[model samples]
Target: MGREQEELWDAETAREYDTPGTGMFAPEVLGPTVERLAALADGGAALEFAIGTGRVAVPLARRGVPVTGIDLSRPMIDRLRAKADGATIPVVVGDMATATAPGTFRLVYLVFNTIANLLTQDAQVACFRNAARHLTPGGRFVIELWVPELRKLPPGRQAVVCRVETGYIGLDTYDTLHQHVVSHHFTFGAGRDARLFRTPHRYIWPAELDLMARLAGFALESRHADWNGTEFTAESPSHVSVYRLPHDG
Candidate 1:
């Protein structure tokens, strides 16, 4: 795990963290995702780890699912609280791996690949254990992340432009290493401000995640490639894995 990168998540970045995805259409991209998470949670209480800017929490709450959130960034939570009726949702500033609220939850969710920000195997495993501890009997822990690094290897490493707008082109670089892969994002704009966002993510196969869940005392309940219920396969780009707690002793 990298220490310097972890510290980069302080106030400054948290303030502008929503720049890339904070437009009016942000809810369009996030609302459906929250809906899927809401169903997995069984329409009860839901907890979100790293609920940045209430992007997922607010809409989930609008769906009648009482949502709570925990984040390491105070400014992010502040932005969330500043929204209309955002204060209605309870939020705590703490680390997801070690923080537990007063009560158990029917659904615990971590989305938008936030788990990778932990940057350590132990922290990742601790997140699993913490999620397990927060769930009620037969509760579910749902996560949305990308697939293994193996798919974006060799020939697939070629730089691909994802989004282009107003003379700006977004380029991505993929580096496949011994175990994990790193993505370098370079946003170029003609006569405009150019920026770079370097994000290193840990990739895990379905089998590996199943083992991790087993170790955390949860069992794999469902695995899908996307929020639309697409089948999970080797070629799938993303994953939505659900792990459930035992119903009885």
Candidate 2:
């Protein structure tokens, strides 16, 4: 993990993580993600990279797919342990790019743009290789990532406001030359001063990701615009991609 990433998701962030109720924990949002992952598990075990707060893993475990997780934040994993038995859905507290958990799995997945958190191309490629190391031959590795919307930036503009709401604002500034972005989030409440959080990410294109998978000994199996299996087109905002290792390997 990058130094910026290590300090960004601190204990305070972990405590306030699910409070917004608009992220991975939201039913309307998490349902389809879990459903897609469960289906891919094929009654075998699944491993989640960056499984924070058990948001998807808990429900996926309830669906009867054995699930384990690896995350960098102990506070985040502590929160997850509050929601699940330690033995039922074990978690390793370390960088997902290199962390190892017991046993192999039929499916290894990273979702909700977690791969971007690595903040470097080399780290991201190592993450793909790590995912491959944990999968059984012919097993699948899935990733859900946002397609970079660089077009939204006007000429000479490096920043874009992606969201504005009653009490919150979200903005991103891009380093186009390096394919890096830093997200700034501000939230306000009555009688309280606004709070700000920033996280860095290295955005990746679909073609580049496929190349990383190839370097890691996996082949592109499928790509979709969403979890429901919509076709990926030029205008899609995000994608769900699946890769597979050769069965003969």
Candidate 3:
């Protein structure tokens, strides 16, 4: 993980992460992701990379799938431990790119664009390699990522407003040449002042991600627009991709 990302997700941020009830922790958001991951586990152990606050891990564990997690943020893991027992869902507090836990897993996953947080192509490739290293033969790796919305930016424009709501606003600025983006988020509530947060990411295309998987000795098994297995079309804004190691590996 980048130094900037490490500092961005501090104790305070971890405390307020799930309160918004938007995005990942929303009422209806986590169900499909957990369901899909559980199915992918196929009665085997699962590992989560960058598993902040156990958003998916806790529920997936509840579904009878053994789950482990690795994260860079101590506070995030603290929050997770507060919700779930350490023995039920063990977590390693370290960078996901190189963190290791005991034993291999049948399924390894990174969700909610966490791969972009690596901030460099080399680091991203290292992450793929790390995932492959931790998997048993024929085990799968999954990623959920947003497709770059470059079309939304008119010619010569460098920024776009992605969301505007009653109490929150979101924007993203792009660096086309470097394939980097910084997302700016602002949230406010009645009688409360607005708080702003910024996170940097290096966006990647699907083909580029496939190459990384190949270099890591994995093959693309499936790609979907969502967790329900919807076919990935050109118009899809995001994707859920599954990759698998060779059976003989």
Candidate 4:
């Protein structure tokens, strides 16, 4: 997260973060995801990594689950606190990669595409290590991230679309020979209101993610295409990976 980007993601903006597209994150997804996690936890407290705006935490709490959230953005947590149900959550303002909270949990959750913010293998892997430190033996860490870079065009060519309301439409062109991926984020609001945010990310494959989990002392336990326990496959569109720590975790 860049300094400028951080400012944009500050409290005021975060308060309306999900207002633009609230339907994208369905209770359908949240419901099943928490149900599976609850079963795995057998009714224990769960820790949410990068629990932005308490989207998942608030609902899970409503379901009678105990959850603690950690986030790097005070603005995000502040917005979360403004919610009627959000105040029930105990949120710590700190980096998810190294922040420590009060106690060990049976479940740790990192939802949405937040992992992309790490932007590096080492940083991403460090997130796993941090989760391990907070989990009890046989505790589970759940993660949800996009499948991979999607093809804007069938061919290797990249497509550029004009900014529209809601958000920008664009793609970062990657040069495989250079081993880098450029992120092109287009922001579209009202008329003639458009902005673009671009950054680079080191994309990782499933096998690489599994390897990182192993390095962090976690073993891959289950993989799902969605929160509903759909089979993970090439066409699944997203991933839900569950990793477990030993009894000594």
Among the numbered candidates, top lDDT falls to: 3
Ranking of all candidate structures by their TM-score, best first: 3, 2, 1, 4
Q: In terms of TM-score, which candidate is stronger, 2 or 4?
A: 2
Model 4 residue pairs with clashes: 137-247, 168-186
lDDT per residue (tens digit) for residues 1-249 in model 4: 446436656765676567522454566666786677677666899999888887777777777778899887778887778763444788877778788988889999888767667766777898899999999989898888765554443466654342334555757565545334666777676778766666565555678889999999999999988888889987776788999988752
Stretches of candidate 2 off by over 4 Å are 190-192
Quote the lDDT for 40 in model 1: 82
TM-score, model 4 to reference: 0.83
- Error at 139, model 1, angstroms: 0.4
Q: What is the TM-score of each candidate against the true structure?
A: 0.84, 0.95, 0.95, 0.83
lDDT of 2 by residue, 84-119 (tens): 988999998889999999999999999989999988
* Candidate 1: segments with Cα more than 4 A from true spot: 1-6, 19-28, 84-87, 155-178
Which window of ten consecutive residues has the lowest lDDT sum in model 4?
Answer: 158-167
* Candidate 3 wrong stretches, greater than 4 Å: 20-22, 189-193
Q: Write the per-residue lDDT of candidate 3 for residues 1-249, one digit (tens) a residue.
A: 856777898999999887546777775778888999999998899999998999899889999999999999988999999889889999888888888988899999999999999998999999999999999999999999999999899999999898898888999999999999999999999976888899999999999999999999999999999998899999999999999999982
lDDT of 1 by residue, 1-249 (tens): 244544656566767666545542365667668779878878679999988787788778888888888777766777787763544788877888888765779999988777876756677888989999988899998988876545434574645454566644555444444234455555565655777766666656667778878889999989988777889987887798999999977
lDDT of 4: 0.75
Give all candidate RMSDs, comma-separated: 3.3, 1.6, 1.7, 3.5
